[model samples]
Target chain A: MEQKETCFAKRVRCIVKLGGAAITSKHKLETIDEENLKEVSSHLRQAFVPDSTSANVLGMDWSRRPGQSEAPSFVDDFSDQPAGDSESFIVVHGAGSFGHFQASMSGVHKGGLSRPLVKAGFVATRISVTSLNLEIVRALAREGIPSIGMSPFSCGWSTCQRNMTKADISMVIKAIDYGFIPVLHGDAVLDTLQECTILSGDVIIRHLAAELKPEFVVFLTDVLGVYDRPPAEPGAVLIQEIAVREDGSWSVVKPKLEDTSKPVEFTVAAHDTTGGMVTKITEAAMIAKLGIDVYITKAATEHSVKALSGILKGGIPDDWLGTAIRYMS
Target chain B: MEQKETCFAKRVRCIVKLGGAAITSKHKLETIDEENLKEVSSHLRQAFVPDSTSANVLGMDWSRRPGQSEAPSFVDDFSDQPAGDSESFIVVHGAGSFGHFQASMSGVHKGGLSRPLVKAGFVATRISVTSLNLEIVRALAREGIPSIGMSPFSCGWSTCQRNMTKADISMVIKAIDYGFIPVLHGDAVLDTLQECTILSGDVIIRHLAAELKPEFVVFLTDVLGVYDRPPAEPGAVLIQEIAVREDGSWSVVKPKLEDTSKPVEFTVAAHDTTGGMVTKITEAAMIAKLGIDVYITKAATEHSVKALSGILKGGIPDDWLGTAIRYMS
Candidate 1:
């Protein structure tokens, strides 16, 4: 097919991640969180289904939430809208129960493939991760999202276990240029130094955001947002915003209106090979440094949708219900 | 991971294709020919497993067929056999019932994606093909093969609907270099002129054979072999050999014996968008022009295994039963 002469390059792009915990039963083997997947994708549909005359957008109700101010539509501020295309989005999801167990058992993260047994483990891990990616693309398709699964195991090569050596973003770019959302996931990939290693979804997002320079980077997680003292302790507060200055100094701000509530427990899945919440935040911080607005919020909620829509219309919503990470530089 | 300094580059590489009709129920949607898959993979295991005290090999017995000469062992000719690592292979499969229906529905092969409906078809076509790839890889793993699925849609680009414009064989090369079998399948991909089109497994094998220049290219199909007059006819006979010249000339030769009951039907599945037997033979003939031996035979039988193992050991069996395509040049 000939490449269409669409102005895809000029449109604002966004990277949204449905965290493993939010979309899959992370603690249960091969189980997907069906309700959560549907809800999160539905909200994504609302945010990206273009401004007018989209079949998905027609007759859909956007009821206002109590105590929240009315917000403008996500595409209201667009200067030159395409005739039929929606806002471009690339979704990268974490490998929850699907990959974590096999990766942990295989020690693929350590980059070991010297023995035949280890090689077998690498294959097993790849199979598991790919299985999850299939489901992810299927779910996205059901929500009327034009998406395709890109295997990092085949498309990426790494020398350092922590970083990809040849992180080919060309395919992803082409998919976007053609208006298809490329969905990628955590995978065990070939490496120059370690033989093979794990490339987490967070790392993929970090690299993509740097190259694409998307307007927004959202990590839809299980938590309400990043918190001041771990959401579970007595009187622990929500950290609504994180600001980084040009000099690299940063500070976290608490929600303006707070109530004394018991903090919620935040923990990683037992089988998680990659470091959990902390790593996600660190990756988000690096992306924020590149001058994109970042959000860590509970997926599939009305508040999160409002925040996402608000940012796309060119600003953080006044009644934002998530932790926002921004750069002063 | 550090690259191992193994003599993988010097190994006799082979490309095997499990024709869609051979491992999948072409008439039924998403149905797998489980028995055929298991049997073909078993034969593959026997032919490729390095001659050693490996468990899978130790338990396997290769008995000579009645009234035939005693056959040599599959790996007897190898000077040095790895204790556990098998000979490297690259497997490609057609989309069969999985993708053909969707691609036809989307007009993907015609390069139509100018509208939302067509775009959805493109996505649907992709999902269907990818779903088959997952099952193929899983089946291979069950047979003790370390394989990973490589989507041509993401890895290839074309300017024409009839042929690929830029087919990248680098990833396949790397996979072989690292001792991993990369399983690729027919897929709906981006085309410069058409927007998108289906890239068949035949085209992939043709391209890879030219670039990798493997010692052998085998297409394990459901048919016993190509016939002089379609096998089931009263006067039909098996065409056991095809020879191609460096000057692009070719000729098909018939077997010594001939006996037939009726003319066999050579039609594609109801949903298959790619051409059936004729296209496969045409692609095989193209590969033959490159001077590599090509085999089109039923996948699991002893005859196919002998031919495959014979070529790997640097000789063609005198009693070969399948149709062999080779370069006279």
Candidate 2:
């Protein structure tokens, strides 16, 4: 079969990125909270598979999460191994807490590309990522959701020099054809341009959304919604609808990337990370343009399915921020 | 299809165990002797794909050489963004390496049993295994074998309680199933009686010969045929076979199980691991009653294949010496 240049080949699709803040309790080291995880997990159940009947989900992965000190992961609760405690989730963390923390600590970077220690360090990093992926899969199974754990590196995520040829996209396309969900997430993707690139969850979703033209892209997070400023900022207002350009490009210019002196830390790519409130808004708005009706909301487990149905029913919720990015079109 | 006693079934039809001594250089972890690897890999190529035309292989995994003083695993070879040496296996590893490694290290016994890691330790381990697996796969690929890394972990190789219902016949069944050459090794496995157990290649193979009814089982190891008495002892004759009881059991009057008080570090099975010359001979001769022959020879890449085929075609080389145990009818 001639391969297509896309992440998903056919069935309806949705891209969800676990909020970093929601996953991490502290930096570099921490564990996942069971209560919070359960609440979030139940919410995803309602949101992703709302219809008592549809099997549209190709698959999912918690591409990002808290790490540093050991913490609970998405699939902790579902690991077949009998243990002390575990969590359940529909995501795959790329050894998040460890990815960034270690990257920062080890000073692992692209410049160290082809360097022995750097190479070994990245191996350590990917090991973290794959381990997290398996956990994500366990969680999905506990929820009775049929899913598979796939690494961006092998299944062809955004990394690898061959990605330029869109080989990874085709891999996903074939997966969909087989009625299998191609669960993916932010990962330590190999970069031909940069020695090593950290593909964020947001960028992963963005790439899949833009390429696959899924029914919609939903950002499930611990927070209730996008905020006017950083969620950490006191009294930050929620910006429900993210505005964007006509071609689905994010209209908000990136102020943080001014340096462009190369990515700040371990990963080579961060320019495409969440435009913050701007990034999600822009992705959703553009996806909406594709007639798929994307949703940009917070507290995903709370509204993932309902919001999905709203999008499916062509019912766009009233913009919490009062800025109608898509319907206005 | 009705699931087997275990939903996911693995037949040890054809298993290849690598000699640690072969892959590593004299206990020093600095380099991966490509020459040695090349020779061994070439031998495997002939055995599995003799004509190099059989699509019999379902998948494979090459493994990263063991770590060196905590240096990252071999997996970085597949990192799209390799941090180490100018050329890791990034460009060569097969997908199986990453996938299986992810499953294994993640504490996931198998896809059927694994979800994803939600726990930090397990998650990190999974990722590490993934990276390591990729490197091995890549190394194998570069050698022209084109194998992928398989994580015994992914398919729930360890974390769970093994059902222990193989009837001691799975190994034989797999051989009947074409292109089912699965590489086995000394790895952490799920024990039917215990929570976790590491099964040595020596033990598993012995059990297999009893049930599979193969003409003969061969262990192509790093050293030549076993020596009688100890290596330091002069005039030690190599035992070719051993005598056993009628019921396919070794009735050793006094099978000296060394180190009864050492606590059996990684395994709980009460068996002798060293100087298998006794165990192999005793066990093989016992199976000989079942009309099957067994051979344990030193491994040398150049001659392993011919030696193996020769034994399989005729009988155990007359060169081997041991107490010939037979099943009394």
Candidate 3:
């Protein structure tokens, strides 16, 4: 079938996850960080080039007719750089203000769909998350990224324990093969045991990283990266590199948990139903176990964008910019 | 699992369809008939009461306590009307100017997803349809209908011949059981052989009618009803009733192919990728064979709204208003 052929044709090469705090105002309900979103979207657009070799071949043939200097292909002047031969990307975004407030109110993140009391919260969460997805898609479009928004809840089924047993990723694959970025966000999904639960974007990114086998998985967050001490502490030090051990444990620089002198102010927003920094690190560790390089960087920072560009080009970015987690066999 | 219990808990009791031309300006690209849509939405909200017996029981006990004249059971009065016990509904809408133009341009209705040239059209069609769904949901909310939009593409799968083999109606049933109207629309769906294809709302309505045994299935369209001749023709007579035979064939009056004297100007809109009036009648007949009453009525007309109210109350409307199709055996 054409569907299978298309899926095999384009092997996904990259995954960029935009954190909720990075693109939306986490503390303020329903407020989007429009400036940061646009800036990050523009950087993302420049990072990946949609492959157009099939059309280019025809253009080359037409230009070679009789005796004439080669006519530049239509995209020659339009594109800022040459098209990436095998670059394809998928973007996963977290649900900040759109879903968090309602979800927390209903305890949906803790699998509260069985209670009739959570009904209003469920409806509001779905509508708000979708509303934000529309905005995210529009921002990406403004930057010339042919981005299409996808709903995780609508496409995936979870077990009673919130284990996703099945997910229809065919559409996502088809979109990528057609040179469109499939944009996904955190959503309220139906679960067999729980009735319904919040499926975070972090978990989705891990699933996608395994399915797509992308060379690099990037997580654009609010802070710089993982740190030896609490990020808010006066003398906290950034941990630039994290390595996965043979036993699947992470080996990153960290301060002892028993150190009472350390000030840990890793704030989880009031309405955030899902866990904050802890969840991100755990998901990143899982992805790192797959032998994929996972970069955690701050959005709207020049150094972060530069590091992202470097990763897109398949090179080592500046070490001091962000933390990179990888497997060491 | 809770999901299985919820699925079997609620049996769908009604279905109301809003036609593309009724809510959208079919001739204009992406232009919505806001006034008609709002009017129709208000009527739809009044027509069905979500089953709230389970929640009402809890609320009644709480309101009986001393010093409390009444407990605002949250949704009490917040809802447009008293929740209709054992009354639940699912709404299917057509993809008007939003999707039809792109679907036709790419010939998706004829299975065009196999070709790479139509890829852009495929993505565009999906986005446009969802955009329209957002508007529809917002309109429903304005009328206090707890409506949630579901994309068929994200929730269903079709075969090579465009037959929907798998559609997750469990979520729909669950939504109704929890007091929400699941709004579905025509969308670009994944296909086994074709890669992707357009699933018309007419086909979806028939599928839902068979799955969910609703008492009355209403089709809100731009015309009054089906007629012996084209409604625009001089001296044309509206057919009040149609009966389906034992063999599942229609007993209504139909025109012969050789009748050249007829004007035959049943205009299918320029961008309409699906079949026109003929298809609607065919689909309605199919639903009739399932032993359900199918009413075709004008959306904006006061008479049609009154007829809808009558049907909702399980009674006969005044005089001849809209055409009702049913089965005898």
Task: State fnat for each of the candidate structures.
Answer: 0.26, 0.06, 0.09
Which portions of model 1 miss their true places by more than 4 Å? Answer: A1-12, A51-83, A256-275, A312-319, B1-12, B51-83, B256-275, B311-320
lDDT by residue for model 1 over B95-199, one digit each (tens)?
Answer: 766677666644678875655555766777777777778777776765667777888876644547557786656666677767777889888888877788788
* Candidate 2: regions farther than 4 A off: A1-10, A24-30, A48-95, A107-111, A157-167, A231-235, A247-291, A310-313, A318-328, B1-329
State each model's CA lDDT, in order.
Answer: 0.68, 0.41, 0.66
Which is better, 1 or 3, measured by TM-score? 1
Candidate 1 vs candidate 2, DockQ winner: 1
The sequence of per-residue lDDT tens digits that candidate 1 reaches over residues A129-162 is: 7877877787776666777788876663454655
TM-score of 3: 0.78
> Per-residue lDDT of A1-329 in model 3, one digit per residue for the tens?
01122254687777888888888887766778999997887677656644432223211011111243332233222333323432588889987666777677556666654354454556667777887887787676545455667787665445456776656576677667656678888887766676677888888888888777888888898888776555666766666667776676766533234453443333212112333656777788889898888888888787566656654236444454677777878
* DockQ, prediction 3: 0.13
TM-score for each predicted model, relative to the true structure: 0.83, 0.46, 0.78
How is the predicted docking of candidate 1 categorized under the CAPRI scheme?
incorrect
- Candidate 2 C-alpha RMSD relative to the actual structure: 14.8
> What DockQ results do all the predictions give, each relative to the true complex?
0.18, 0.07, 0.13
Clashes of each: 24, 90, 1
